[model samples]
Target: MHLPPPSEHTMVRTERVARRVFSRLNLALLLTGALAGCGGPMEPAPSALEPEGAQDVQAQALTYPSGSSQTVVSRRVVFRNGSGAYQAAAGFEHFRAAGAFDIALHNIRIAEVDAPATREALVLMSAGQKISSSGHSSGVTGQASNWDASCDSVSCPNVSLDGRSLAMKLRALGLFPSGKTYLSVVNDANFDHLFDSDTKQRIVNGFSNWLQAQVRPETRAIYLAGSSRGGCLMMRMAQALRANTALDGIDIYVSSFDGVCRNSQGELGTFDSKINNPVRPWGTFYGAWATNLTAQFPRRDRLHIFHVVGGQEVAPATGIRAFSGYAGSTPPSTGTNLDWGWYKQTWVKWQHKEIGNPYTDPSASDQAQAVAETVDAHLTWLDARLP
Candidate 1:
């Protein structure tokens, strides 16, 4: 026989009891997880610094992409950090197990809009003159060997250095997430093959696109890095970025290695010497970053700027040389919190022969590799300063 329906008051009372019991069960589960060193997904892991902003969002596993996809993530990006409006793109690289560790762009090309997108970014600008190339194609994690940035084309603008090695190193250190950190390079697409106004504007425009396209509420941190001529570009880019409103809330980190830059007047003279191309000189569009930055940020610690060079990088020879003397008239480089130099710091040659073997080789030394490690450490320390 069917039981009589319960009274309304009795049913209400029963529901209240059920709610209390469920709450207790939830608490028990939470306690169990904590005991096992597993915080609930909603809770960020204990961190000395501010936790990642997008850590609570669920995402798909990082898989290889099939094509060139550099679609930008639509978001409200401003121009508080730099000159032009923020912009960026991405392409996916799905390297097979057999894929070499060379200059291949690797998985997650900015080109693949369909591939997974991450709020955290690792952007790398290559040296001047050299375009994109397949770098250090045949290598694996945990093993050290020779590495090279073999570009896709012989022509400079046609090639760009791959950032797989840099990304890999960051990932191993837990600063960048696996498959989430989107690495990129913003070249002066319209350079008359020289670092002039046209090239500077082009780079600024590309970055504006990148900044506006790739950011979302999920975005947490952005790390911008460059080597040699690229370092100079990164500096100018960062200077311009300071004016962009898009970078207002996001954390930004910019680093340079053996970089060369134009003086306050947009001149690339040799430590106040003659210029290579007297027609025009490309600069930060504002002033020398090493000097002007001190006025821009003031706090010094608030600005996340890094510079690493090799002692072998001598004067009047490379960008680092230019950078070293950039402040010959000034003192205590601006925003350069982790300034360092090494002996065996040959640049273009190092990229060709000492890709994976930086610190080990005598001529190449371990400068680049050591600098990378320093970047990771510096980033972690910076994180600690955040809210």
Candidate 2:
């Protein structure tokens, strides 16, 4: 049976580039900061509607190599070390609690999505401005769901969009190793600053810290899934892990669903003319990053990167639609916007949100079926990469 429709706030295209003004901080600046240390005073931002017992946290400043600093803020939880490394921090002891699920010190939500019969694990980063809700019926008796009781409507939970449904489906079909597999959901935390450079940086840092702490070299496999903006963040985190010589030779897989990237000023574009243009900072950052990855990774079996797109989610040639980047236009026939040319592509006959979270828009039964099929296809593509 279908679940209730999500709140209107959930339906809004949170992926749309927010036009709000903020200080300039580009990708280069962020990378510089990651290499440097945190400094400067932080500006206070509103707290997320976090789960109960969540604390009102303060934002942390990260100093970059450029001598400029950006304030990285998280309403629900503030990382002890804003530098984004895997370090022991206060209030982090709960992650080792004697149970299948526990909130890590960085405020990451970890749960056993699958039966711990195997050591493989999946890490998920949901699209921007979304939260975990109750799972819809799977129509299969004794089927497990992706629901987490700790998720509250008031707070932005760490669970990704449609994360529960995906885990349940993968488990039922044996696509995911059911034995001892953990699902770590990383939170974006600040939808209010959805397109801000610091907001996105927080996600990248959180995932990277969690990965460094959780995934051991002996771990058999690691699967990463990201939707919308998260897709880019996942790749960024993977790139960092690859550079870390200590975690050498471990298998890593990435699945990107309609991934899009924005610039420091919260602008987006898919066309090369727009992206590569010096004035259009939005598309330029995305274009350069995608191009770099394509050249370095070359889509090898070990690198396992897959990209899926909603057939209808084409952006305008101008690419800078204030509210919906994918609206008001069609993709250029010249192939300019296909940033990740190396990725094996899968196309789904749905819109952006539908493909990202099929359980959304509960207006038609066929939509549900189509979502199920799309998710099945994505999982199958990922499963084939499993050793």
Candidate 3:
């Protein structure tokens, strides 16, 4: 208490010394903090630390109405050490898988909406006509031994084939657009007999009339797929449809798988040949008729005639060279008149019977992969072309 009464200058000098010591202590603390930060991890810049556009992320597994489920993740990215470098998380895989699924699902819904409300489709079988108990020439009726189409009622319109065929498989896979009523017509080896002059025009015309009656004002297009003799018969049926004035605006598409232009007499004819060595008139007529009808539709991709032939086709029973002639040698014979039909010689090393079967004949397992590929390609073609 007595020391406080000393001179004012002595008090001022003491205060200044205390202030200098406090400043030195503060500087020492700052240097120690900076050195510790350099030894440890540096704090990331706010912008780079968090992923861009990440907000309220809540992802879970999604289950569709069809009982299918998929795991979903919110897209995210992370940066390291305050640098711009980043790595994607599970969201990148989600983008590829979910993106494709969404696209395909969208395409299917769009197709269903765009298809005509009422339309007709046909799957003509390789079987020929059979004399029913009622004495009428009806197409064959029976279930296939394998997973192929079964014609419950032959020559009937809007009748569905119960079992699985190429077309039926496509429908099951949703390749064919919605609202289509499909029918499968069947026959046996006697199918070629209908091409005979004695019955060709009458039988074919009757079949054509039955089919034409099914087409109404609302019908937008006609799809015809056939194998073997049915493929050949489809040409004639198409001709009849072309002649009918009622179906002028309706488009027609034909798919012929291993068709042979053989007359009723079991003799082959060249395309547009009137020489008539075997005197098969229908053969010449069909080629010229197809050329004429296809000429009417000049629009590209409007009407399509597709012919697919198997390269390994040969006589199965006799093991002899047969059916190769139907493969076509030149442009006109290939049904390419003004780009009418697209012909393809497939690499599906299948014999005559196996090519049209629902699956490869069990004995021909070697060709199964090729057959599957061919079917997938055709399905893709139908998907792109169907309205």
Candidate 4:
């Protein structure tokens, strides 16, 4: 049966806050950031990259040099169905060569209309920004419809965008660009309808399944990040990794203000739950998704997860607690906490009590600073443990 829609109270409040934040952030970005030129409308689909006889493909080999500290390789991989070939565009900061190091970013797929263009664009934009700031070059890979497995699911009519398969594709790409990779995955849904049922399901399936393989030795140190639904996928992936022995080496760090998940009691748990009564659908969906993945490797101690949520944000507190319950207690506490006040306090201390109103402050600006600190703390912990 189809799930009920999210509550109006939560939706309305989220929209209101989002609009105000967007307006302010846009102004700030416009003033300080250089906007990328939007490419003309998507051109005709490029030819297929898949070989005629290949199916259930194997991962390609990508070896990093043994003593290579100066060079960091970055790659982007995309899996699409009926869309077109994946092409890598040059000239972005992420792809430019830097001193004593060749930092390359690759795109997994070319532009395809089947998925939400705006979401894809935003991901590309974010990747570009990250590359610019970090001085890394990136590339993209392409795959065709035959590669998608979820579209072949009984619930869906034909090969739809499968998060599981897409994850596999990314894993393959990571083999080559192995040093430190930033992977982004998005479902095939319109940006305006990101919260809809189908879109949510796609994200759940995509991320949960992908997390299964990403935590291996070949790719464990990669950083996980996303926004909105993408953020939700990242959280679920962290939870899944925590429960899987095969993923023990992976260190996950996520910041999602608008994602949802299920508590151990099968209750709806998300930031939106407080405002929206009967979060059953979201809970059930996420629970089912997590259960399926956890069952694949049921041991509790295999995965160690660390995440931060805005205390003011509805889901992080409840969701993290529920996830902690599912994961059971571990040494040093698998979950770390963060909220608006905590961030504000940290900001004020760092700035010598000069900043004001963390709650009403711009989310983008505040979150950027908050996430950096979170990542730094996580890295310190990881270095001591992994090194």
Candidate 5:
């Protein structure tokens, strides 16, 4: 969610949270760079072998019957790198049985953009350089292994060592061999440094970049979903697709978890006023990020957007506020709510912010259920619109 220039009160609160999150993040990045420079000093990689009685949850591989025309295909479609655009092999599996086709599973890479700027920020941060704005860094963290999960479960989950996890739970049941399903897993901070390159490029590109790649002639119906930054990317991509008219015949269904949105009013706010202050670091970070993403799609009315936020989650609370308070007219005023009305008329659908974190909080089971229900509703709409 993007915010305009903050009010005095809002700026003060935002500065505090921004400092805290950015400080720790900057330190972590510096430490990582230091260890890399030390070569042979860092610890060895962890063994995949599990300890005794570790509740072995084997990574289940996609299964297919032999001698059948039905085939499961998997690939990672790569786009931009620091040097230029390139296609990477995405791990995808196509399943066909009884004359039916379905995308059993696939992994998409979210590579970092503008590597030079990222490197400069890292160097300055490591050398104790202080900047007015918090340098760009991955928001969520966890091990890469966390993201390497089996698709058998409804919640097909993935995570990086830094604690950032992408957990998508699709509600559709009874898989058909001929039916098609699109599952997109976005790695927000999947970084790979090639030969001492300064910038760390994310493995999975953001939604905007990804959509630009898929707008090719070969692309067909798409079921898109993302969490956090990915969610912001998804929303912007939908807008782009709609405006371009390139996706006119394509059927699309998009969803986000704890995702942020750009508000029309451009003021900093929280999703839940009662639970959160007017401004926080999350709001600022998303504000900045969403601004960058939305700026790419000038005409945002082209695609239908479905958004969901947890009332309890800090990010969505701010998002909710931005949505409700969006001012569509010039000389924006506090009482004017333009985006709210436009959202109701368009495909913008929002649910109550009840679900906390889909990955961490068990209490948010109900919220998770709501998300699944919403996806089902979207799919129903999509099926009717496409084919």
Candidate 6:
């Protein structure tokens, strides 16, 4: 079941010194833009198969701090398993309209994965993509399947998903929300560009706006997930939602994977020479905002956050040196590329970080299920904490 990498792109190993120097320059330029309060126009490089107008309908420029700005957006598209074509995740009526699930990916902090997640929408929503389709039959029950509505070779109204191992698990759990919204900015050069305070605000605003217009009153159990910097953003948004009067009456659960998140615990900075500064975002200079943001909530008990990490370290083949800030090689929405690096003494250590409590890193595979399991465990944890 080997799916070849994109013919145009390959994840080859990059030289350490060159990559670091570039990353430093990138990070510096980012900080400079942050301080200057003025940014030049951004160039939109296409990553998905569709044009911007097709991918995002309500396209508009979102202003950012430092005068920097780009078009931040929310989009929905569907991928049917075993089919190579993509369908609209839209026109499905309302938020809880069945047949699809709604999830939020946040990168509200100084840096986040919103860009990569959105850019890779084609790959993310590609029905043919391996991550979503690989060996999903193992999770099926009875002759009927969540992907029974095959769209390939036939005109069926329903969208065929990646069966139970992936999207099906979500649908069965009722976490898959309809009217899917993708949140991210264009010209996302990763790292520094990601630290746009203005764009973050706009994205958060978009979330609120959608809730006002689309979300059905009966919608319950919204699953909000983010990774790395996105994790910080998720927590920030979680705090807001908990206190938000508009979002009241709906249960919100958060799941963060290898995300630099915490109220005031855990260590920061890189582990070894192999690892350049880890994006332990929850406590970075900018991360303090997340802490303050989370604390402002009146009821912390209502918002439950789950932390999960499978293979909480850089891939052995890539090592820390093969790092890319959600670079082109990265797959969308999936948190694999931006996962945390091992905190060992050196690459010589070459050992995987100990799988954390409530999380078992099945190396690269099963991350989706791992996350679902983590959320289930968090619910249990929440129940225990409540009474």
TM agreement with the true structure for every prediction: 0.46, 0.51, 0.47, 0.32, 0.37, 0.34
Best by lDDT: 2
- What is the lDDT, from 0 to 100, of the residue 259 in candidate 3? 50
TM-score result, candidate 5: 0.37
lDDT of 5 by residue, 252-298 (tens): 44544344433433311222222221222233322111122233344
By TM-score, who's the top model here? 2
| Span of ten consecutive residues with least summed lDDT in model 1 | 56-65
Please, what are the lDDT tens digits per residue for candidate 1 over residues 1-387?
999999844664565456445645765776677877754455556463321211111111111111221222211111112453322212111121212221221111221111246545444433332334433221111112212222122112223222233434443433444466655443321221244554455444554445445666766666665544555556666655656666666666665554555544443232333211111112311112233334434333324665443212222343333343222345432212223221111112123122222333325454543323333323333333323
lDDT of 4 at 358: 16
Alpha-carbon RMSD to native, per candidate: 17.5, 21.9, 31.2, 23.4, 23.1, 23.7
Candidate 3: where is the Cα deviation over 4 Å?
A: 1-142, 146-164, 175-182, 187-190, 193-195, 263-301, 311-348, 362-364
Question: What digit string (tens of lDDT, one per residue) describes model 2 on residues 1-387?
Answer: 999987633432221112111112453566467656557545454344321111100011111111111111112232334554433333233222311111333334333233243355544444433333443222110111343333432223333223234444444444443454555443432222234555445455555665566664346556676655555556666665666666556666776665655433432222232222111212222122113344344334446666554423224342321111211144222222222322554433345455556554435774544444345445555644554
Show model 6 residue runs off by greater than 4 Å. 1-161, 164-167, 174-193, 260-296, 309-387
Model 1 bad stretches (over 4 Å): 1-115, 118-128, 131-164, 177-180, 185-193, 264-290, 296-302, 310-320, 324-329, 332-387
Error in Å for residue 221 of model 2: 1.3
Rank all candidate structures by their TM-score, best first, as comma-separated numbers: 2, 3, 1, 5, 6, 4
lDDT of 3: 0.37
Q: What is the lDDT of candidate 5?
A: 0.30
- Supply the TM-score for candidate 3: 0.47
Which residue pairs show backbone clashes in model 6?
Answer: 37-66, 38-66, 77-89, 101-176, 101-177, 102-177, 110-195, 310-361
Number of the candidate with higher lDDT, 2 or 4 = 2
- After TM-score superposition, the amount by which residue 39's alpha carbon in candidate 4 deviates from its true location, in angstroms, is 58
Cα lDDT computed for each candidate against the true fold: 0.36, 0.40, 0.37, 0.28, 0.30, 0.30
Q: Name the 10 consecutive residues with the lowest summed lDDT in model 2.
A: 51-60
